[model samples]
Target chain A: MPMTRLYVSVLLIAVLLGNNACTHYYYAPNTLQTPFLQEQHDARASLGMISGDEFNGYEVHAAYSPLKHAAVMVNHFQVSSGSGSNVSSSEDSGAGHLTEVALGGYYPVGKYTTFSLFAGWGAGSVSNNFDFDVKADLSFQRRFLQPTVAIRGKWARFGAALRFNQLRYVKGEVDVEVGEPDLTIIRNIERASPLFVPEAGLSCGFGYQAFWADFNLNFCNIRDRDDYHFAYSTVGLSFSCQLDYFWRER
Target chain B: MEKLRIALPLFGLLLLAAACNKKADFNYYYYEPADYALISQHLNLPEIPDDYRAQLPTHIANLGLAARPVEQDKAILGRVLFYDKSLSKDGTISCASCHKQELAFSDNAKVSTGVFNRAGDRNSIALGSVLNFSAYYGTDLFGPSGVPFFWDNRAGTATEQNLASMTNPKEMDMSHSDIVSAVQSKAYYAPLFKMAFGSEQINSERVSDAIAEFVNAIGSYKSKFDKEAEKAIGYNVYSNNEYKSFSGFTAQENAGKNLFLANCASCHSPTQSRPAKMKANNGLDIATTDAGVGGITGVSADQGTFKVPLLRNIEITAPYMHDGRFATLEEVVEHYNSGIQAHPNLSEELRAPGGGPLRLNLSENDKKALVAFLKTLTDTELIADTRFSNPFK
Candidate 1:
């Protein structure tokens, strides 16, 4: 217990120290969607509340299987946050949203385990305003490949996923009034992109029949951090509904 | 199998199509890359003129201090840093916020505002009010040999003074490490830093050095006083009997010049290139409240003594004195004319025969003429020089 407490303390200290007052985060990974389907004609839909140090958001996830080993997924996320008094910049508010679609195949390894590989594309926009003087509105596109493994029981489920993503800023509009450092940062990102980011996630849940509740944690890191500000961690709570035999019956 | 193979390639092509690379527009007018390019083009760092490399005085040269010519690249980088408000903690204040180019690099405010609208304690001094800063203080030196900085002479060198202003709670309110990180995080600074220092590695010392180079290059040698003095170079301008008045000057201006040479030149230097004194007590108050240099040394004898600034561009840099107590040149001249307080550490030059503050009793015309002569010190060219203007678009 003492060791656990010490580790927690160190992690908190690292987090607090790493996030200086001047740093502005531009991106955070969404919660991993793990639809533990066992056979053909299976489907699941879930809604999650996402939270992080700089943002609070919501996500919608839907997954379906039409053939024996084929699956398709779609996800949407929206997040908004405002500047606290501790923030050094005069940023008044910020918001961002992303929607993605993926097509992949899943295989049942045993009665309780499944392995899946997915290829996806996502696009999003982020906007930040500073006391009406400087407004940054940017749009970005992302292409990613994700692999996931999951375990399921009558009443419990566990899952893990790793996503490799290529992120590129597609378009942007920044107010001329945006002063140095911020303006320079925007120009740098535009010139030095597209960035490769890798994300990892873990989730655990309890279920009975068709309904389930899950807790998720995810993290992302930029491979080449050349003047980019991305949130490293996110935590989410999801409620899901599963319809395994409904499509088979029809 | 055929359908799946076609679908895979089709999906890949779809993703590739996302790379339209549409350029961003600012207010449907300006593009980011183009703006940066335009700014880069405008800042064609001009070479420093030879006249700016004036000879160091014998006393300063004897102390191993030499006039270092300003490098164009370093000065250009420093100019950007000077105007960049991002150096402040709140991104609202910069060195140029107080020291403006049009006002002879001085603030009109009695005490300038800093980050978060915090009020400063002392009036902002003009950068090259009387003499070029490098000629007077010797840039980059950080010890007792060089003249100190600030109204109180609290900082040792230009770098220390820059750092002090950056970190002051009422000023920029940023740490050295934070400033370095801020500079490093900015992409446009990469080229600037590389140009100035041969690499993009940024540090607080380098930042200060660049700003010092830019500031040291600010010279005000084209004033009317300088032109008039130049014509009197061969004549015995110092001796009243042999010296004929300046040919360029009107009768009234020459009268004012004569009064200034007799009274103010003891401390302010008749040549107008350098001040005769670094710091002195002008008896602004009988008992010192701000303490001035005495605050730093904890010495009572040094009480009320403040840094003596050059009088160049005095006509425009109003709200004068360390605390900005005087509002105009008339008020400033009045203070020295008849209102010098009897402070214990009053400057010897301002002492009367009875050991009190010397009152320069003069007629109304004499005061007006003195004011007129001070106006001759204004350098219109320096204030309008494009090399020192803001480079940002």
Candidate 2:
């Protein structure tokens, strides 16, 4: 009887915590694109949920159903720091890439549409940029066409998406012109706060599912420049997997 | 009844529209100009000239200034840039390395020093009357506001003048990128770049203008001679004939001043003078290793010629003459006094026959008073002005 009471109390506590903890709060401005519902491939692949019978080189679709349609989905990024760049050198970041860990949760309201918001932080030496809060913005994924092949038990979906992001450097404000203009002195200047830069990106991903779990992966261009993606786009790829326990209700 | 029902539906739709239009929660970001230190003092000459507006286009056409206008923020940014040694190959020297404010903005050494302590062949001249100097030769795309800078009339425009130091190999010894890194690293200058040029990127013309503004800021108008001339003081000593005449004068000093007016004024007139303001080729050396003006223009008539220097703070800018050949003002005066050499294209003022009319010979007393008068031209207040002190320390 005591263990039964403890079990009920533990479940109640989990439900309370799950309800109160701020899942990555994302701000979905009306201008954001709608998430593609038919794009189940990315939603599943991000969680690395693929069936044993799945084949390589062939795009696949995956599905995930939760008791509550508005539950938040988060992404984790492992990030690092301490890799200072050579300010005078025109070189690329060749050091062993550091992991910037991040945790973000976004919400989806329907099968064909999703308006998700997330606030996460990533810090690595390669970032080189100053940060206000390792953060991200809302992404609207819409499933224009849901590719469905003859499935055995679980259903699947696949498509692409458009994302809008913001990068900030408010913590780096600097005082530039405060000092006296004495050309006679050399080396330093007036000080001020650090600088902040804003950026945008475009992405496409796929997903898969099985009796046990669901997974997905997404590749995107994450630069803030207007036409920086004109020639060769820098890519950001995310991989994720979720437990099959959430599907027990089915 | 049907018409009333349709109208009521439209009213309901309008009401819903207004409800949706109500304000929602939001966040935003804003930027403000970053502050910086002024390492050198400036005199803010001639209101930047009304025509200075015209100089903007040529500057914008260049890749550097196209990023920012020649406006206030850039002027301030240029001040800091003028003093940053990181803009050089080695961080020891900077734009202010040679153009010191205490020395009338000119270097105190004979030949200007550069990175690695490499010395230039010519003396570093003070920065003033730049807008009033000679014009350009049109070898490249020059700017509206330009002037003659070096001993030779080499650089034609302010833009060119700004670029000269980078290429000189002895001065700044840097490309635009190195300066950009040095500036952007300050943690403070990133915003200053935005304040001055509205961007966080740095370039050369901006570097030149900042230095130029600080340079133009210091002037010789505060001299006792200038202050008295401006009526700030009572009818001063220079206004009296007793001072200029033989009354208690060093005979050599009077002779030197007379010789100066007759032979040197053609080019090296006081800053207050106008027109072909002054360019000279004193019959100093017959066969010259330093080609002077001729080296710049490739003209035979200009051989061994050099810009006649302003005599404002000549005492401190010593190691006199273009090559800094004379260590003392006495040696310089005596060079023309009895040692005028014969050259094929020497100035007629010094080359007149009859033993070259050695008329500059004077009693020692004459030399003393003249030196004293020249001393009065030195604005001691300028050298000690705290406004131009180093900002780093």
What are the lDDT figures for the candidates, one per model?
0.77, 0.42
Mind giving the per-residue lDDT tens digits that candidate 2 earns over B50-160? 111212122112212221123454545555666677778888887777878766677768888888888887877765322212222123423532335667868664456
Query: Evaluated with DockQ, which candidate comes out highest?
Result: 1
Native contacts retained by model 2, as a fraction?
0.00
Highest TM-score among the candidates is held by which one? 1
lDDT of 1 by residue, B191-218 (tens): 6776679787999999998998788878
Q: What ranges in model 1 sit over 4 Å off?
A: A1-250, B1-67, B139-145, B240-243
* Model 2 spans > 4 angstroms off: A1-250, B1-72, B128-146, B232-264, B270-278, B353-359
Candidate 2 second chain TM: 0.70
TM-score of chain A of each: 0.84, 0.32
Model 1 C-alpha lDDT per residue in residues A10-121, reported as the tens digit of each score: 7644543343233345677888788686776689999988866667778999988766666778899887667533224566667788998877777899899999877788
Listed models, DockQ each: 0.07, 0.01
Model 2 error, position A180 (Å): 23
